[model samples]
Target: MAKQRKIIHVDMDAFFASVEQRDHPEYKGKPLIVGGQPNSRGVVAACSYEARKYGIHSAMPCSRAYRLCSHALFVPPRFDAYREVSNQIRDIFWRYATEVEPLSLDEAYLDVTYTEAFNGSATLIAQAIKREILQETRLTASAGVSYNKFLAKIASDMDKPNGLYVIRPEQGEAFVAALPVGKFHGIGPATETKMHNLGIHTGKNLREKSLTELTERFGKAGQYYYNIARAIDERPVRSQRIRKSLGKETTFAEDIHSIPELTAKLLDLAERVFESLSKQNLKARTITVKVKYADFQQVTRAHSTEHIIQLTDLKQIIPLLLEKTEAGIKPVRLVGLSMSGFDVPVLQTHQPQLDLALNDEF
Candidate 1:
């Protein structure tokens, strides 16, 4: 028989807000929001647990969050500071297991199946890591221990604000069966509504459908849902995750109809995207622009070249790309810019092409 894998998913409690509270002790007990100003057209990046009590959450408009709690502290994100702390936390993960897959700056998955630490007790290792994090960084973390990545991730979220939950091998199916279908990790609001319409309210209800029935309904994702309903996820914890693309997007508080405003927004997004690309020392041959209409319709236009893309090239190309979209005809609510096609090395031999060609349709 194959050895069961021991996976642990660790997530920091209110990561960005907690870091702010730790750095600025006066903000400790108060409801804090980490994002843009209330008057700005920005969403909350992160909010403190205290803020959550007021119904404030990440991705909600800062203005809405302000209305929820006028007394809540609103502050911009300190990405540099957060990245530093995340590095510190990542160091702690490395001390326990070699197979660590970081889901984000605040959460990661660690496969400790073969780790001999603490007699290979995954729960003990989780406790030690949490204790060390508290001792070193004065921050609290939650951990979930299970035999697979999906269960481990769900277990981490079961208890919040410095909680540790475990799902044993024999108990996995029962635990999943009792869980609401909406609570499944991959099921979004739209998918949950679809499942509910089909009388699949919980894991048990989901497991009743055959593989063919699920596949016919959810396409490829149907198979995933069917397996997770039975607590079966065989995915490994991949440590080295290669980034495929870098992008930045903005959602306006009000829809914009002017072509000039849309072009300006696209330009700003391109600058931010290019800055991030430069920080990563990566180059791209393709640039994509996405526009979401006020009616919720979305479209994208892309351009590719034989040479590496530059900010100057983006400035010239964005206007032409925008003309292809219905932004001026339809009110645009969101605009995004992204750079991809980084598989080629920076020094790869390619004939310099002058023509700007629209190649990709994504």
Candidate 2:
């Protein structure tokens, strides 16, 4: 039999806000928000725990956040400083485990199944990592230790701000059974509401449904839900995650009703996406354009070619693609461009042809 994996998920507490507060002493113990000005169209990127008291959170519009806490300090994100601190945290992870999968700048999963450190106790390894992070970066982190990534990730969130929680292999099922379905990591608000309507309110409730029933409702993701409901997740902690696609999008404070304005916005987005592609040294065979109308209806149009997409190609193609959408006819609130299908190289035999497809989702 294979040995059970020992995984630890570590998450920084209010990472961006904490970093801002640490650098600015006067900001400490105050409700601080990190993102755009409250008057801008931008949303909150992160907020201090103090600000969360007023129901402010990441991704809430800055205007709404301001309304929640009028006196809260709003500041822009310093990604350079955050990246420096993230590097420090990553360096610490590498010291103990060779298998570290970073989820973001502030969170990661470490597989310590084979490590001799702390006599191979995953709990002890987590404790040591938390201590080192606090000492080295002056930032507190929460850690969760379990036999699988799903439970480990969920366990880490059970406690907060310098917390350390562990879920032994035997306790996995019962722990999941008692937990709320909404608290499950992969189940977002929409899915949670759907599950609630289906009378699947907890892990036990979810477990009662047959695999076929779940698959019939949720499609491919149903298999994942079925497994996690029973405390069974077979996903390995992948050390290197591949980049599949690259894209950029922007939301406007005011809706755009002109094709020229929309085209200009898409060209700008295309430039930014191409710049990112250049930085990664990647070439794309597929280009997709996404538009969201003022009514919140979203649609995508895609064009795939055998040749690598170039700026000249996009300049000509973008305007044509916009004609397929209802952007100018209906006010457009957002526009985006993305490139994908990177695995294939350019073929010399076939001439580049525009393979347009409608009803694509981004």
Candidate 3:
């Protein structure tokens, strides 16, 4: 017989907005949005529980969400703070497993099959980890324990905010069949609508569709759906990889329409550029300026240096902004500055202990 598999997925509750509310008590219970301004092609990065009550959610255009929740408090994103918290959570996850795969800032999958705590019980290990996280972080996390990635991630969301759900090997398939198609991870609104027309609204319905027909309709993802419908996700958890980029962008307090005002904007952006580079201990030979125009046309310009980054590079490149602006420059709306080639000091691996702080609710 094949050995029982053990996996756990833990997701932080409403991560970005929750962090905002946690830091500022006054912001709690109020509709809070963290993203760009509503009118300027902005998108919702996160929303508090209160904002969600108005049907506002992440990735919805801020303009549309503004209409839905006018009372919402719109705040710019604090990605720096969010990244710090994500590191802390990542540290906690490594306590139980070497195989820790992060999906994003707020969620991850841990392969605990080799951990001492498993001892033939993935469910018990998941429960203990959830409690430990709450104790250490003063934040709640929902956990799902299953034999594979797909069912485990699905189970994590089944009960949210602060939940521990377990899908045993014997019970997994029945659970998948009863699930709604819309609830599957990769099934988005467009595909769900297509599946609905085919009278396949539930996992069981999709199961009845022949594998070939499902593939014809959904392409390669249909194969993924087929395995999921039967709770047969075979993907293994892996460790986090180094991040790709670390940069920042800005929108002027007011739009810059003229030739001269735009140059001054670059000066302000140059200051921000140097600041991020200094903090991250990076010397980027590449500095990119992202320009958004009044009509929303955009362009990018980059200046590379073989030498280490210095503020003097900005002085040299600021002169070239006008020429870069020519092609797409229709009354420049917003300007942003970014520096790449940052690397984290990867030698900082330590075996962290679980720092649990629990309120102990029965």
Candidate 4:
């Protein structure tokens, strides 16, 4: 018999911002912006739902957000506090399932298909977990329950500030089909604009296009669009999935036309690339620059280096990599930097995750 799939995506409600409000009761019911200072060219970390009502959002310039909602309470980041709560929440997760994969400090996916709780319906488990979360954390979380990772992750966002949303198998594709194209996971501003220009303004519009049309329009993302539009996602809820690569991508709010501007963007991208990869010990041999033009056509340029890349090398070679693709790209809508082909260590490596998984075996 084919095993039934049961996955849950648990996302903390306004993780950082909520933590601040929880710690300081005065911050509750008021607009709060948490991150670096507004004058320091800082961006929004996370804002209270109250601030969201004022058009303030994460990643917005704190200065601009200030202009929009001057009364909003502003505070510097408290990573230490958030990290502490994150550990507690994770402990709560491990009690339910060992196959837990964290998307970030505040979100994770749990596949309870084979857990002791499996005999129960996913919705019942979802409710049980939600009640437990409220009791333990005194914080709200939104949950999505479904058969696969894709839908479950998206479903979790359906209800916010303490919600449990379930998409039963029967609803499946029909549910996704009813959603707007902009609603698909990862359809950021640039992709949304491209889809609108391509006459795919909603999920139904995207569905009307053939697989070939989507693939031609959005490159690799097109495949994801086609399948997810009909809720056909099959990806497993992988736990401690060895991250093969860590990379960063950027989408410009405005398209770039000039060489100097493009080059500067590339440098900025490289800096971000190095910053992200620097935190991990993973070493990679290839660096790839991904570009999407204003017209939505996408292409990549990759070069293999004999030695593993460091921040210095990434910054130094970014311009050269741009030059290699100079003939093909223009008026860029988005640009991304990625590295791959990690060199595996020979001897016994330290994967603390294996010990955790083994401990769960008994």
- In model 2, the worst 10-residue window by lDDT is 353-362
Distance from true location, Cα of 258 in model 2, Å: 1.8
* Candidate with the larger lDDT of 1 and 4: 1
Write candidate 1's Cα lDDT for 184-254 as tens digits: 99999999999999999999999999999999999999899989999999988878776788999988988
- Model 4, span 1-362: residue lDDT tens: 34557788999999999999989999999999996565655579899999999999898877789899988889998999988988888888877764788888899998776556634466766777778877877888899998888889889989887988888888877888788777778898889999899888777788888999989988998888888888788876666556666677766666787756776777777777666666676778888888777766778888888888776776567777777664234677677888887786643322123211111111
The whole-model C-alpha lDDT of candidate 2 against the native structure comes to 0.88
Model 1 residue 153 distance off true place after TM-score fit, in angstroms: 0.4
**Descending-TM-score candidate ranking:** 2, 1, 4, 3
In Å, residue 112's CA in model 4 sits off its true spot by: 1.1
lDDT: the better of candidates 2 and 4: 2
> Per model, how many backbone clashes are there?
0, 0, 5, 2
How far is 128's C-alpha from truth in model 3 (Å)? 2.0
What Cα-based lDDT does every candidate model obtain? 0.89, 0.88, 0.77, 0.78
Scored by lDDT, model 3 comes in at 0.77
Top-scoring candidate (TM-score): 2
lDDT of 3 by residue, 198-277 (tens): 99999899888888997998899889878888788887676745544545666555566675666666777778767866
Q: What tens-digit string does per-residue lDDT give for candidate 2 at 91-159?
A: 999888757889999999987776667777788888899999999999999999998999999999999
Q: Is candidate 2 or candidate 4 better by TM-score?
A: 2
Clashes of 4: 2
Worst 10-residue lDDT window, candidate 3: 353-362
Clashing residue pairs found in predicted model 2: none
